[model samples]
Target: MGHTPADANRDALRAANLRRLLNPASIAFIGGRSIAGAVQRCRDFGFTGDIYLVNPTHAEIDGVRCHASIAGLPSAPDAVFVAVPAVQTVSVVRDLAARGAGGAIAYASGFSEMGGDGTALQATLLETAGEMAVLGPNCYGLLNGLNGSALWPVAHGAARVDEGVAVITQSGNLAYNLSMSSRTVPFAYLVSVGNQAMIDVAQLIDAFLDNRKVRAIGVHLEGLTNVHAFSAAAARALAKGVPIVALKSGVSKLGAQLALSHTSSLAGSDALYDALFKRLGVIRVKDPVSLVETLKFLSLAGVPKNGKLAALATSGGDAGLVADLAETHGIEFPPVTSQGRAALQQVLPAYANIANPLDFTTTPWGNPDAMRVCCDALLSDDPGAAIMILDYPKESTGEHPDCDIAAHAFADSARRYGVTGAIISVFPDLTPPDHAAQMAAVGVAPLQGLSEGIAAIGAAMWYGATRSRILEADSLSALPVLQAGQGTGSSCLYDEWDSKRMLAEYGLTVPASELVPPADAPAAAQRLGFPVCVKVVSEQLPHKTEAGAVALKLDSPQAVAQAVERMTQSVAQYAPEVKVKRILVERMASAPILELIVGVKREDDFGLALVLGSGGVLVELIRDTATLLLPVREEDVRAALLGLKLGPLLTGYRGGRHADLDAVARNIMAIAKFAQAHADRLMELDVNPLLVLEHDAVAVDALIRLDA
Candidate 1:
């Protein structure tokens, strides 16, 4: 996304009026008889709106009144669907805007997706569309199930539901595929935002929030345009009791390149998007199936107040299967209390295990009363949610009747106890559509696949919990109002000593140090104290130790002199043209408890972000890091630290002294504030090996890359 000022109010108005445009009483379809135009959309959605066709070659389009051009319309239609060649799209949109069309979707290809001249033509289309909000100059169109209004090109199978998930996708084909998918997830709206010249996905999301029937919003993105706009809108959705799920493709460099060529939009850093999504209460999923499954769970069950989950199955394998996958997905299965176990013991035979993911052991098969008793005992503990595992018979063998008894037992038990109940089929294809519908009618979801169902439930619970916190904390109020403008100075790197000095100004504890030319290194080391560390200072080298430019533990002045000589020679050997300008003489501090890395770097789309993880020489090898957006509190840093693999170590592993975590948290806060202050001039800041001792944390090594 380009750097642009966020306009929530102006955008809100455009989005608010989208209801009229999307579900307009009248629509003028230009290029009436073209491929997948006017005729297909009207029939696809069963649209009963007044349709006016415009084509010079036809007197009428298939019994519908046809005008020669836009000028011949009887009245200014609220919406216009343009399906013309790429060259004619700009003029067509210009005419619509001239006559005051409420909105227009230009369903044409060969825009920026074609590159070269097409990019120029797309720009003209945006310039031509003055007040009219055009969804795309090259896209499929919108599918509005709630209002029976669709601008989509092909047949989209959907029926109106009370409230369903709304989806917005950058790829027209993806939206088309989703519409045609056999998944049981009902949809309220499907918007295909291709080559978003005027109204991007973020703006469209703001529009969709107006519809009270929208349960959740799912987005399929090639890339994001205007992150702050998304942030603002997502915050609004969070406030409005809306959940957002995003399946963001193209996170890899090669994948991003393809996305850029396909959409003419830059795939900004995925790390930035990840940080922002988690911060803003968005559930990020991997694929379209997961997106739909997750949304379905959210729409049906909402968020569970607690995560203590339980599972029931006739087979021990199914019980263990669910328990294993649930753990992998972070779903908890709370243990049954001794009292609850006693109750379950009575319901089951001696062989049946009274445990979470309890196996009923087929002892009560063909007996709904016994099944109900077993379920009631488990529900007595009042687990947040529960699922019963059953595999329906494909044929009417003698055993087919048992499946119904199990299903009815689950439905009856759940309704009686008022627990959120779900029936899981071991495989997706096991449950027939009719049987699934029957379960849903009884207030039980016939979820397919154990892993998929468990994952959806876990995600739904997490989103619900996260949204409540955001609403309570009013986190939107905490998001930074970015400081505008760019720095004029060029970027330059600073050596460790200089970097530490800058950090020390903000109250960071650094080892006692001095900067001096190599010839005076001995005196500097003596003044700094014995057992000093010497390093050749050169900002040109990003990594000093790798270049053999550092020497540690010099207990005497002679040792310091020899160390400086060796470091200077090593540095010159590594980079022959580079000069050893100075050397840093520092006290050899005692070995600390742990080494940690803390860094701040500006992302193109997400602004400044911080990274904290394992540090020292194995920083990259460890690859255990957490990324967070700026303006974080001490508690936020502390929480992030505790979540890391290094967390247990920080709490004093094997009876070691607990590092001053409070002081570390304060240090992070101070450094973050310093980064914010110099955001304009700073590009990157790192304090790797921020040593944590028994009582104090110190910056043993530092590096600052400034945008000058």
Candidate 2:
């Protein structure tokens, strides 16, 4: 799904046809135990849709009329919940497709999850079932609370809600765990996109984006089937004001392997996903609890207008806890205005510390009107959001009025000032379940755990600010689409001289250089001038410096000639197989204020990606890099460069070594354009030690590997 001609149209149609699978007028079941469980689930959830069971031998199942086959059904079902054996599931689904059945959930696990043979079987299942949106051949199926149409095949502890966050997960158990979380997450719908045989997470997200009933989306992912489609859907979700919070599990090495074996999904590098999430304005959570709690808070409190939040803590310990956690999560608590400080001083006790997380301890604890006045005075400054930390007294256990004043005061202040409000408990268990419902009743989220609450609030504010940025910004359709490979197998490696030559053709700054045989090294160096660098150029040696094939600061022709001979001998000792055929001679480059690494490679999952980071030997150790998909703007390049920890050094470390960022940006954009244009042929391009001087940037060393 590259920015190619027909991809957008194809994706548009695919997204348009994805909604029919979620809502079904009538559903048919094709197995026994699963059918019974589904029936029980439907009864519990109050689904009124017609349910028809199918089995050749049974005239009735669970005391409901059963069908002998697809033909015996009263009419075409909008969705089919198929739980037959693995081999026969595809045939039955194809038959349903022929009969114009709306959609299906194939809950059999023998498909791609098993390995190569299973992958082939799943492929055949998809090829045979044309235009019929089948959820999976290995899935737990869909749960819909919005319409009370439950095709789920297990007992779930979920309350029917007309509006809540829609959760989609690659793992069915994760989806179930989220639905049954004691955190009291408001769940409108939950979908398990196992193997994504027909309906992937991207399409589900796209469908959910248009359903205004879905307030937000919480996604649990192993890996994405389509990054391009997901990017398009994410941008739409942001623009439509629906925040998406994702917990990605397949980021580590072991987790990636497990994901591939589980669903035949390719786990691209985690850095790329980070960059993608940032570009699409998504908040990536670390674990499942974070995912659930964040969704719960967002559903009740709503996204704040910005990331600036004013907090309330009763004691010095609680205030310090808020400050530490908020700083760690990038949540800003800007200093209150002088007016706000004056107002707080008048409301608080004489000894209270009047700060952002103001400690107005027990001053107005039981006084709702006085607390509202404190809140109203603070609201006059219009900080993005507000939260109050309070642990309900242990004596109020099992009672409805437990901490009623605390909860009501928090909720009313938000309502009175039109700001989102939340109540936090230092420990998750301290926030009893009975009071959770009570807190929700007054429109304030009952947050649990100090660190967890702060992190969730930070994520909520990040989404709020990101959404506002998108709604006020330009269309993101111009952002690049990464397509699959097209180059032939003949593409191969180009040595340093040739690589630089090709880059120079694209207007990138490369040192003046020329390639010559070992015998001509002296003449080439003399022609280039004194103080030149000489390198034994070979396709076999990718890291020439590590291989002892490069020599720098050769002050004279004799020095250059001697260095070439020494490099050849060193290469022989390091690797006798490497052929030292020629040498590269060029005038030595003046050192820059900072050196950066710029690279481009085709990732298996995400097509063309440009990687920019701190260069040199520490690149792998530090790993301070940002990956961007191709066809990016110059502004994106500039932002990526300035985002590095080494960025301050380039901007003049202690106001002494300032390099021209505009020049660095210009070179980066040039290389990016070159990579994008040759994306099909270029397998990888590494420009290490890209010199960022006071006035210009230059590629000091390069290596190019073509696609094969």
Candidate 3:
């Protein structure tokens, strides 16, 4: 169902309330001594806000006078931390809402996440909160580093930052752990959205986008409650030039199962999430470390204009390692210009390799002037970004002024050239925190660890390029309406003949065919052409070749008749129940340049998705495919086809005939349009081995399942 105007107004109001809750002028802790730590944290963070304690049992708790009840508080607080039990949490929330409070954090678990009675309690909590924003019934709550307010229940390691990345996660433990990261990721806020009973990750993202201090948003998602809302919020971020980095944890089967039991989060198709992220320019990272590192790079150095990078290292081994890792991450190192190499020759020793990922040799290692000259030469080409690998020595070892000098030179040169840059450490722990902070001050990302640094750079490059494309195209303005499917009804499968007939109306080319009785198959084949294919027309047998119900290369009437007889016997033996009454006789297609699969998968949450991949018998074995949400354009289809392993074949691999790619894309778009038209009832559709010939694309075999 679509959201009404009233719903929009309520959402706007809740967003306003959320702003006050996140950065409150006054905070109230409505519990006993258990919440004293939380109150203390706010004080330690330098939150100059009114703090109120409410407890009927104790006159004084944590050296602060306690109120008898919510009614006894001086005035409605901007934010409330309800540490009461699950059943009482709702009443506390109701009282706060009645007092016109901004928002509250339900810190106790057992609601909704525990199921049964807990689910009922959660519904009441949501209804009671009404216009007031609620964080979670089971979460640890939020830390606002921008305003120096830590509403969190436990001790956290985050410090105040004027501007930085905001990290939001479904797991409070993950949020807590990320707060303690020593990687120098300037954190503006850390939010743990537990069950998402009232406010979800999408709403938080939307709210964060309004804050100028939030340079980027990093999210750790087990699953999404609202895919559409997330897409919209991500698009807004992309347009506003604030990147979103995601760490999704439910890719594996066991992990998905665990996610469901842990938080009642349904780990929907990961591929669909990939498509959604790709569409909105959200960068996806693998681990928590990468998440922090990527956000650090984005927040500090910002995104590069392109994937091209210029790397510098003192040792040959470090240079080679950078080259290999850059290649692995799809980072390009455009060769240094003649001007750059000529300048490098003047500063460095003759043995130094003057190239991109330049090994500037140990001769100029300790010389700051030579290092700066080499850095200047490399940046002369105006590469999209640059990185200098420098690992600091242990403090016990010595001062290690060489690394510091090299870092300063790189930082100064990058600033002079106005290029995005990073000083990457080979080991995560080698970079000194003081040095990292100094580099960050000059707008150079002090990235720790070689592999992670390059990965972060790669992610930034992808975001830069993809963000430009999405903003220019404006394709994510709105998602296609999700079509409601018939509830738990038996599905009817369309036989090959019928499926082809339906597809042909939508501009897909299909071979001339006739569906006749099995006895008349030979006559129909003779009328169609000489060399034809015959297949038993039974909805039960979707895979005719596996059932031996299909015969190819029937060049004569006798061949057709014998094939039909064989197919009938094969079907009887294979099923012993299905009768092969009708047969589809079709003219044979010429040898295809390449075979491709065009399919439409209807998912419950994401709606229709178009799947394109290498087709034919090895489709499953090859397992090469790309998925896109439906209502796709022709360019989208073409790009997906080109991304496949067999995609090169379409361009005439090894001097073979080139398939008409435009024609192929058109055929796929036709299938997409057909899927959109039937989105209300279509369950699934497959066109296996959509033959890509030199001149045209044809759907030789097809099937469709619809709610009956």
Candidate 4:
């Protein structure tokens, strides 16, 4: 999509009418016969807008007045719905812009989506709509139920349209799917940003943030043209206490390739997107179903004040399954405290397990107080935000009473305690009558399966926890600009010493190293003392171990010379183009230590991400990397380091000596600060085998890339 300065100006103008234009007063349709079918559908669906049609040939369009054009309209409407021919659509939008039309839903195609001449034509349309917001040139249009403007083709009908959540999607088909699909949740508005040449999703988000009635914002993005602007808009929304849920379509390489075929979108790196979401505090969902379920919860019931969650299932198997899933998603399932157990024992029989996710055995299904006991425990005593009641209704309970009564009692307790609740029932063949309605009456929903319900609630809870912590943009400072052809070349720009020098300048503690050419290798090793390592310095072979370019633990000058000769010959054979800069001779530490890799990459969307993991050959195979956004706090850095699989190894596992982890955290913080301070000039920095000895840490090897 090609956007001009003029289009940006138009976005600024539309951003001003953030409230009124989005929730328009009365939307006027400009084409009669062409969009007569669409117009009648809107009217039939109970659109409260004054639909004035414009057709010079007819006085009425399906019983509505057909004025010649906006010039001959009865009044200047807040918005215009343009449904003219593809060739004439641009000219009509130009006229609407001239006539003080605040915005338009351009429901015509044959522009940029096609190639060559069509792109030029689309550029012209964008230039002409320079001061007014245009939703689409090839689109199904938008819906703002808050203002009674139903510009979408599908009818919302009696599907809970009030107090709705807003949607913004890059693809028009996906936007329409939200309205037409089997949506268990309600919506407030939907905008399909086809060829976002004029007004983009960021501007649309600004509009929604201003609307007090709009509870949450959901965006389905294929590509983000401007990450800086998008990040700013997200911060604004977060500041106003509105949650933003995103379903980013192109995060994986395969997914990016698929999106390119589907929407002609150029997706960037998945790692970059992950880092971006972490920095901006955006809740990223894995699939479309998860997106809807998460938004439904946040927009309606909201999250618990605390992170603790408790589950009560009739089956111990189901309870264990939910607990395992919760742990994987980072939800803290604090086991029922000693105090909590004492409280639960008073109400429950001796047979019931007094643990978290209490299983009140088979026969207890008949008792309703069993329901009250479990609900009260989680709600009043434990004080959790949400609860799940796994009910498995069966016909074989011949002598027992109704199970629905127990479910009702549990839900009633949930409402009384002001906690969000839901049901996960696994009935054999048929569903109990009015299960969803009965649950909904108590502000709860029924989950069909145990795993499915837990997954949905777990996803929603994870998002809720993350979204609330999204910080304001003011916390960040201005980033430095990257020079072209700098960090991105066929090969990295820094040699071993140059790389280490760059990192050391940025505050990282690098070991003593000297880049000694083949001639001076022995002399350098002798000066540095014995038990040193010699490695081929070539920007070409980044992972030198696999290529036989690295040699470790040389005790003598003779060994150093032989290692240098072998490395030189190997580099000549494997990587002929690389000028063997030197054989870097550095001090090699002893064993009884931990080896780790600390690296930084300039992510495409998120500026920089710091990675901490086990170093050396297993770096790729074990893949124990834990990532954190750059410019992180000291505590956050410590958390990121400790979160890794190898983190405990550094802390002395299995009676091994404890390494200096506090020094390691300080080193990571220093690296992060370096990346943050010099992001413009540095593309990547890698410190492999940062030897954690008993008392201190040493950077055994280092690599850095700078702007070319």
Q: What is the C-alpha lDDT profile of model 3 across 1-708, one tens digit per residue? A: 779998999888999999999889999988868777777788898888899888889988767788888888898898888888998898899989988899999999998778899899899999999899999889988888887778777789998888999998999999899888888889999998999998999999999999998999999999998877787788789879999999999999999998887777788889988987876788999999899899999999999988899999978899999999999878899888888888889888887778889899887778889889889988767888999999888877665788888999999999998899999999999999999999988999999999999999999999998877756777656443344464467788999988988988999889888999988988999899879999988888998887899999889999999999998898889987889899999999999898899899987777888999998876989998999987687777788888888888989889989998988998898898889888888999999989999998888999999888
* Tens-digit lDDT track of model 1 for 1-708: 664455555455456446567768777778746533555566556677777788888887666667887877888777777888888888988888778777888898998888899988988987787667788877888877876777766677766655678899988888888888655666888888888887887787887788788878999988877777788888788888788999998899898998998888888778778888888889999888788777776666566666767789888898999988888767788888887787778767887768888898877888878887778777767777888998887765767678888788877877787777788887888877777777766667777777888888787777877877766776667654234226555788888888888988887888888889989999998898888998887778768888898899899889988887787788789998779878888888788777889999776666688889888876888788888888676766888899888788889888877988987887787788888888777788999888878788888788998775
Tens-digit lDDT string for candidate 2 (281-376): 889999987887788888888888777877877678998889988998788787778877777777788887777776767777667676766666
TM-score against native, each model: 0.92, 0.93, 0.96, 0.85
Model 4, TM vs. native: 0.85
C-alpha-based local distance difference test score of model 2: 0.80
**Once superposed on the true structure, which residue ranges of model 2 sit more than 4 Å away at CA?**
1-18, 337-339, 395-402, 467-475, 517-520, 571-581
Top TM-score prediction, candidate number: 3
Please give the lDDT score for candidate 1.
Answer: 0.79
Candidate 3 wrong stretches, greater than 4 Å: 1-5, 478-490
lDDT of each: 0.79, 0.80, 0.88, 0.69
Candidate 1, residue 649: lDDT: 85
RMSD of each: 3.0, 2.9, 1.8, 4.5
Candidate 4, 273-356: lDDT as tens digits: 665665555677877766766666566555555566767776788778778866766666667766667767777778878777
On lDDT, the candidate that comes out on top is 3
